[model samples]
Target: MLIAHRKKRNLWPSEVYRVKFIDEAIITVQSGDGGRGCVSFRREKFIPRGGPDGGDGGKGGDVILEASSQKRTLYFFRYRKDFKAKNGAGGQGKRKAGKHGDDLVLEIPPGTVIGDADTGQVIKDLTKPGEKYIIAKGGRGGRGNARFKTSTNRAPRFAQPGESGEILKLKLELKLLADVGIIGLPNAGKSTLISAISSAHPKTGSYPFTTLVPNLGVVKTDWGEPFVVADIPGLIEGAHKGAGLGIRFLRHIERTRILIHLIDSSSIDPADPLMSYKTINKELEMYNKELAKKSQIVVLNKIDMPDAKKAVDIFQAFAKGIKIILISALTGEGIDNLKSKIVQSLDKLDKLDE
Candidate 1:
């Protein structure tokens, strides 16, 4: 069963207002109504019997949703619950057509999934930058009296009314789009590793639960290509069942192509070095089997610590067939090699897709 963990809060003062990341939002959207058609007759000094000369009404505006890389969250939608497009202009006399209503283009973060609020059906999954989807379609323009003029009725006086626009109640869910996802237990150096590889500055502390939200960073390699990485909050044994902060952040890493499973080398037990490793994987499997099936790279972090060598050796012995990387995020050791490996894995995945 799914549960909502977010809470509503009032907007703080400018000085104290931090950039709060929101992943979900419920909103109402309405397209503009079509303008009414005109009914008029041509009247001139020389003309004896004037004919119908009314023009057609303009079309209503559509409500469009566009994906953007600049936005990271759905924070803007917290206060703004409704969105409306402009109404079209009415037709004028002398066979003149009315102007079309302007379209409303709302920019949202990439990897946002728009769904119908009532039916819970997914409307669109916007994962690419600059991708656009029309959530609400505008009404069609009305016909003028000139179109009704026929042989029997030479000068028609009536005009067709414009159609009504579409209205929709939508649910926007944002899943962070990252090439790599860093997952591990609490205080396992996930935040430290992201800070070392990319420009993101996630808060790090000695205690657990330091990271409340997922942090994204863009890692630029020497090969000139940059890939995005996300540092997800730690998971516990019963994380799939809403234990700890796991459920709140697990969805953020769903879009990642690769997973970097980081382990604390210093805290690993020699008797059961793979205990934490197995527990984390079990949680992933319980939450989503596909998430557990994704390609993963096991990494032992905090190798700079004095007693880490013994634990690392024990873990290596148990994980004999699995490939592992040893790194010290605080000392910046093995980060370059880690970046190279990530790039190579990404390249292989891209080739397979092609």
Candidate 2:
């Protein structure tokens, strides 16, 4: 029950090859072929009786996938859809065995899920860094002609051919790992708020959807441990149904323990103060119930605006019992208080889990 992203190129007609590839990459991995066996005869001047002196072929290389913390997205695999390992060397004469091929290690971001492209089967889930999984095993080497030398048949002339390598079509999906996820409609100042609270320096513009990719930042508090936060792409009405950025990037926040529901006070409707808030929650529920169930810190942003006070008052009047924080990301108002609240909420969740 997975949906493809709205924005994608028609790389392949099959669903296995359909990925916008920003967060997902569909590619092929090929292992090396085994080397051919060698055939030779030992003719020593000093020794009269010299038997066959052939050697066995080398084994092919394997295709390995490694999890790394350095990569944040699947961007590197956009143009590169195919990966290949080294081929083993051929066997040498005088009973010398051939050299083995090197393994190909592809590094992917942590929390990446590997799946088979053709069957859509789960291969492995790499959650921690430095994890590795070998998908394709190398072919076995062929035996030399010396092995055929027996009492009845002596000095065999032929050798075995190399075995072919394996080829597989695989798909990769990256899910961001963060303590908190910032969710709201477009132009709700999510990027700005994250920048103000954390070390992340994302581009801030007045236009909507300016922040295309998700931004991760680490918030260090004086009293508690540092927590990671992500500024997800904006969500509008019908987002779950592929409207706007849609559910394409929503999967990135699946691991987040809490959500920061931000809203722009100036954009609040006087007739319906909770329209935007309700819309975002509805989209979350439609996309995933767990997302809606996550604890949220409702924040009203852009309080420095002239009409923000009246709009905030209207929203608070309608939203009874819901504690809301007011902040102006541009002026850095109530940002510290908001950060403190986030730490407190995270600590409470940890205690409950324990």
Candidate 3:
């Protein structure tokens, strides 16, 4: 059982590591049922032949799903799968209508795709903040004896019963929505770079974690809108073949407009500096041709290490057509320049799109 802490503020990148990262879930939901109507008649002393005065039944409550920006995962539905709205109150005597049932609202993270569990069809795509949709509507209230009373039959004996609510099985899948995605092989300084760029504080080691989850961060700018960046983890030699949780991480970056291909200078081989780069790109092309065609910003990190400059020079010589940025992420050398370049690239893409 995965427990999700739905906090008041947005989750910092550090908390993501401690908590289990869940992107998919299945649950059941139900709407409220209508209340039954009451049966009564006017039996006053002055009115010997009083007409029927029964009240109408109240309407049932609806089950609503609301998208919230505060949430980042479908962990809310981990434990409590079943949800039901309040049933409407029954109608009372003396033409008193019953109380309406309350609405049930469920908050989910933005970029969540809702699907019908039984039919396997997409129900709705909640990509924007505060987006809402009525997954199931409550049943209508039944009529009362007074409403059924006619000229010939002044006193109806019985009242109508309440209607049943709707029942549905739902499937939820979450995809990260970010303007920029950082991709690289293990120990490519991705975690360190993301931590430097954003508020993410992922574990930085010599490729320690067996399953490193993706970390998301927001880069605030002095000008223009704030853009989101995600550190996509788990891309290996055979990522397209679902090697080592690679496919899962690959899909997360599909929505990104630009990709930051971070390369470790120390890991580069002077004989074949482009080996790693070509391997990663080949995997991307195999998985999805469009992913390979997406815009990329090649960055060479860890220039402070020994032989790093030599390897970078070799890569620069071989990869003449492409431009690359050299930086030492630990020493913060050329970080600001890298950020400006990212912003510039994004701005250019935006202009071309316009």
Candidate number with greatest lDDT: 1
How many steric overlaps are in each model, in order? Answer: 0, 0, 0
Report the lDDT tens digits of candidate 3 across residue range 237-263: 888887654567787789888898988
- In TM-score terms, which candidate is top? 1
Model 2 lDDT at residue 12: 36
* Cα TM-score of candidate 1: 0.55
**Worst 10-residue stretch by lDDT in candidate 2?**
1-10
TM-score on alpha carbons, each prediction: 0.55, 0.53, 0.53
Off by over 4 Å in 2: 1-176
User: Candidate 1: deviation at residue 284, Å?
Assistant: 0.3
Question: Clashing pairs in model 1?
Answer: none
Tens-digit per-residue lDDT, 258-283, candidate 2: 99999999999999999999999999
Instruction: Report the Cα lDDT for residue 4, model 1.
Output: 30
